[model samples]
Target: MDQAETKEWSRRYAGKRLLRSEILLDDPLFQQLINTSYFTPVPSIVRNYFQTQCQRCGNQKRSLFGSIPCYSCGNVHVYCRKCIDMGRVMTCTPLYEWTGPEMDWPHHSNACTWSGELTEPQRKGADCIVQAIQHREKELLVWAVCGAGKTEMLIPGITEALRHGQRICLATPRADVVQELLPRLQQAFAKLEIQALYGGSRDREATAQFIIATTHQMMRFKHAFDTVIIDEVDAFPYTNDPSLPFAARRAIKPEGTTIYLTATPRQQHQMQIASKKLPHVFVPLRFHGHPLPVPEYRMCYTMKKDLATYRPPKAFLKWYHRRKHPERQLLLFVPSIRLAEGLSEQLSDILHDCVIQAVHASDKGREQKVQQFRNREFDLLVTTTILERGVTFPAVDVAVLAANHTVFDEAALVQIAGRAGRSPNDPEGEVLFFHDGKTEAMGAAVRSIKRMNKRGGFR
Candidate 1:
């Protein structure tokens, strides 16, 4: 097209259009052109028009209201026509949208179609969280029960953000949780770009429209999102580290919103909400279309000092054998990796054709082990709290060995119990806390879960 035609087309297509041209900074012809033209006097009016320093390059030079040739690099610096249209130049580079409003972008249409009904409290809490996000609140704490569909409730907020052209992140503290969420989220947001980011993920840094990551990955992002949803907000890394909170805040835009989903909010966060310092919502029911199973705690006080060295507690072994089904699996939660491995070794010999597997955070084949557990290849799997919140295994009975372990706090115990009855077909399952002695925290955990269930009419 001729210069006149080009100018007319540019004018017609004016406001902040994304250009797809390569900037030639080092081409011989462009360099020569710039070198020869660098000395040419910029019009006095243009010289004083307005100056802008390149944010990336830090070059302070004369600025024009339109695309001008860079004297140093010969790259074209396109300017917003509004300034030129108004016949005024400014000192700052005009901000333009390379892409139109986010809503214009195509999004994945997958959504939760599960027909399960939420209890009244669950519904109210979920609605509160959704409303907070819709209004762009700074922070919200979703305090729900162990089995409440905290992740599922965030679906509406995620969909709304995607439809509005906003970027979102669902970050958890565990990789296994990230894996469990991928398929569920994929099925929900089928049309949108969804990427699961973690250490072993192939697309760790993929520029997806939606991201589900672990808490550790939060540090890599610097103001890269519009909405940040931290699932298991009260879980490890997130609740323990002040830095993770700072990183989470920094990951979002200045006007961005954050949503914290957890069955158990930390004491500090709870105190803040109690004092009306932080906004809060509460979900007291499970989403499996049923009430949460009240865990039965039994003190299997054996005189044996080392539970691993002695034969597995007779009562615990009895419960395991009775609950074991050929097609069903059981998860045995031990206190530490050493105990987990020792139990796995001992249990392997007692049950015929029973594959007892142990998994921990530092285990090399953690992913493979989890996959096997999910596939029901193993009859029983021994693990630490690593499998607590993020994993879901239907038709599995859970046994908490040494439940009084300090690490098995209220939230951890609740989450561990949650793994038992996730599937509707397996809505009820056994959760036994084989403790040597009952601790106050254990009583609190049981009471907390029972209260939530009672409030949700699960009794």
Candidate 2:
């Protein structure tokens, strides 16, 4: 390879597997890379690859990876629709991985200079992670409460992984978390470069020893990390779709291991622990050693219908006017994006000196709005469940406007209640589940919170 060409390829596509069809401009150079020993080709489409599982995402369902007409290649091609959003993969499409030295595992350093301490329970969880990584254990689940210093619990394990020269990737379901975790990890592991990957991300150039990325971005990787830690394993995007776990699995080396961290997990998570599919650590206490806030259920039988008339139920309005004060911030969780906006407008007119805004997936100014809310520039935030998981505000109270909706499942309800009483300065706060009628999910969520409190012996 020519010196200039080698430098260019090493800098840009060193660790990437790119589709030949996806590369329109650098065809000649890429071909030269293949002609040399720097790049190698792999079949884009495989037959019953992975025992009828989609090799890319491990989808074994015959329906998902079924055949589709490929007008691009003038033939029928079995392409994985599950991961089609990443790129098109057909019978004729060819994928290439860099076989160059630049893509080597230790291509970056393993040195780190972090010296943070973990809480006792956190240290126990952290030690379990180190064991899982050292032994290459297939699965490990950390069931820590929302404010249980779960992120801090990861430090000792991360340090151990780096000491043994293991490459690590922390994958989360939300981009907001990716943004949040990166800085903290970077600050802690001062000697290592950590790259954060998300949609429209700008940190593609760094060959990081530690990579913090969204589960969606994991699809672009193959056999990459030695230890893959999936934080908030049961959160959105991953919860809404089944393919993300497969992607996280696919990104790990054959001898690598996975660690799942979550406050609210499904029954299947419990099943995995029981069936010996995954070793587990349960930490019911937060770092502050305080009990999780239990929700207070208030019934508003006409709320679902009253929103259309832009008239909130008399019961709710009365409670809001009485309980909500200017000194305290509030997070109002509505089920739908449309409802969040409508509720925000209605609340603005009703409340005085309260600057309220709504945020959701399609909201272009979502990040900005969240920052403004965090800075105390806004008195309240009306949001969909998108904000249900990774957001925290000091002494903020939470209210679920229509908690009886099908969207408020047991796990969702638990996570929503978790939004309140997170900051230690405000160890206790209000969590209201305003429902039209009680459902099993709401009852279960309340019981679960009380159970945890009893376990902690917090009155």
Candidate 3:
């Protein structure tokens, strides 16, 4: 191939491992590139004729593989069902990766444009991240409390990586986080181009050195990033889904750094830390230097019955009417979508002067509703656990209507309570848990909050 043609192909294929069908060229041109030793084809499903595993998602379960009659090859083919939503990975298909030279990323003398200074705790965490990248550490866990300026702490490490011309990706499990982070990152590094990708994202064509994407988007990458920062590492479905971690492992280079950012680390991670198997940094206080709001448990014995009858619980009503800060926005967390919608309507009836809305994962207008709430367009928001993490609403008092429900686990309850007291101006916001009965999860959540507060030097 000519120099000009090679450059054109290199620009498209560099740092990307794509299926042959995803390439925008004809078979003849693709063959020419392969023959020139620029592209390498890897089996999509490696098999021993009995056991099969998907190379993309790392699905090895025998139950997740199924056979389908093939049209191109005119034979029965086995496909991986686990990640079929991304694209089918069948036995006949092959993944293509560039075998050419690496792309030269641009380096800036001053990559971070944020003028704000980090607090002492945040600075300590930032140094840990920077050292991990500089030393090429395989993994580093950042265990910080909620509202601890975790995102700001990453600025220094990202800046250091950018100055070294290393590619960085900050991936999370939720799309809400990707949307929330895009503008912040853009303003932080105004000179560099950043690609924010999620499901149905419009910026799929651009490949930038800095990328903020959903963990699921990492499935499309292979050995592409030098530093992979997994934000909200403890939040679902990343912690619950095995494929997500697999994709994260596949996206980073063999010797790249992986950093995990979370307010609440899972049990396994805690054990690893105790055993001295995982290197970590801890930031126990929020950026505002205030104590976490410990949730107050209120018994509403008729909580389930009231929801069935579409009535607001009397206990919740009393607290709402007698709140210390009536002007503060309210986040009413429910366990299920039906309860969220029903409670929203019931509250709207009683609180005639207040604007109320309900949002869930499947809500098509969820993004708009959340933005409107942030604009103070609404006074109360009824939502499911989807908003339990990766969202920040300053000056909001939070309440979980069914804190005793099976859905309200210890980690989830802690994250929900964290919604309150995030803004320094309203650092004493209330967090109430109204339930029919107190459960072990609720007790554990309050204990966790108190432990973090004591660690933050709060009595």
Candidate 4:
């Protein structure tokens, strides 16, 4: 290949392993490049005497592999079913990557353009992050409370990484979080080239030095990033799924720094911190310098019964009428999609003057509905646990209809209650948990909030 052709194609293939079929360039050019010494071809799936492994997603589960008749190789091919949604990775398939010289990333003098100042706690955490990145630490956990301006604290560290010409990725577990973080990061570093990758993002074809992508998208990259910041490290499916962590580990360089940001850490992480095995930074206070609103427990024996009868619970209605701030918006959380859709209609009918909407994970217009609620086009929003984290409504009273349900784990409950009291102007917005009976998760969530408040110096 010519010098210009080699440089342009190498930029696209660097640190990324893709199937030969995925390259969209002319066949002659692709063949020419693949024939050169700069390209390395690897088998997509490796099989040994005992086990099989998928190089893309790092999936080794024997149960997730299936055999299919192949036309290209004329043999029975085994493919990984776990990450088949991204693409079918079969034994016969090969992944091509550029093993050539690294591209020169642009350097910015003032990478961060955010005008807001960080709080004391935030600055401490930011300093810790900068130190970890500069030292190239293997791992660092940022244990901060919800609404503690976790994103703002990363600006300094990210600015440092950019100035040093290091490629960076801020990966989260969910697509919604990816969508929400893109605009904020873009606005903060308006002069830099940034790309946000999700299932349906239009920027998939564009290459950028900075990337914001879902953890699932990380499967497509191998040894790509210098700094990988995992936002909402406690959120699902990241917490439950093994492949996502494996993908994240494979996506970053061997010596890359991995920073985990979370409000509620898992028990394993907590133990590691307590044992002084894991290095961490703690930020107890929020950006507003107010304690998190501890949720009040109310007995709603008729919560499920009222939903069964197509009506709102008496306790919920009573709380709604109390009017601590009736003009503020309401975020009502439920356990399932059925409850979210049912309660929105019943509550809208009872309160005729205000607009109401319901959203769940499966809803195609979930993003649009959330945007409308953020714009104050709707007064009440009924949702499932999908909105329990990574979203902020400045002034809203939060409630959970069946807070004792099995789906409302400790982490979920803490994140749900954190939806309220986010804005400094309305720092004391209320939160309520209406339940048939108290659960261990509920009690733990309450205790966790109180402990955080105590650390914030609130009596």
User: Backbone clashes per model, in order?
Assistant: 8, 0, 0, 0
Stretches off by above 4 angstroms in model 2 are: 1-16, 21-40, 47-85, 98-112, 324-326, 457-459
Question: Using alpha carbons, what is the TM-score of model 1?
Answer: 0.71
Q: What does candidate 3 score on TM?
A: 0.95
Which runs of model 1 end up more than 4 angstroms from their true locations? 1-126, 204-206, 303-310, 321-328
Report the C-alpha lDDT of model 1 over 1-459, residue by residue, as the tens digit: 355643432222222111112122245743443354421111112222466432211224443235666665667654433223222222223322212112223444444444445556667876876677678888888887766667667777776776566778888887878877898888776656689888788864346768898876665455567788888788887776555676677678778888888877777887998899999877766675677777898767781465749357877877776764546688888888888888788888887678889999889998899888888887799998888876677788888988998989988888888788788787888888998888887898888778878877667
Q: What would the per-residue lDDT of candidate 2 be over residues 45-142, giving only the tens digit for each residue?
A: 56753545454555566777767777766787787776676676666676777677654344323454567667777778888988988788888899
Q: Predict model 1's lDDT versus the native.
A: 0.68
In model 2, which residue pairs have backbone atoms overlapping below 3 Å? none
- Return whichever of 1 and 3 wins on lDDT: 3
Better of 3 and 4 by TM-score: 3
TM-score of 4: 0.94
Task: Give the local distance difference test score of model 4.
Answer: 0.89
CA lDDT, candidate 3, residue 204: 82
Stretches of model 3 off by over 4 angstroms after superposition: 2-8
Clashes in predicted model 3 = 0
- What lDDT does candidate 3 reach at residue 258? 96
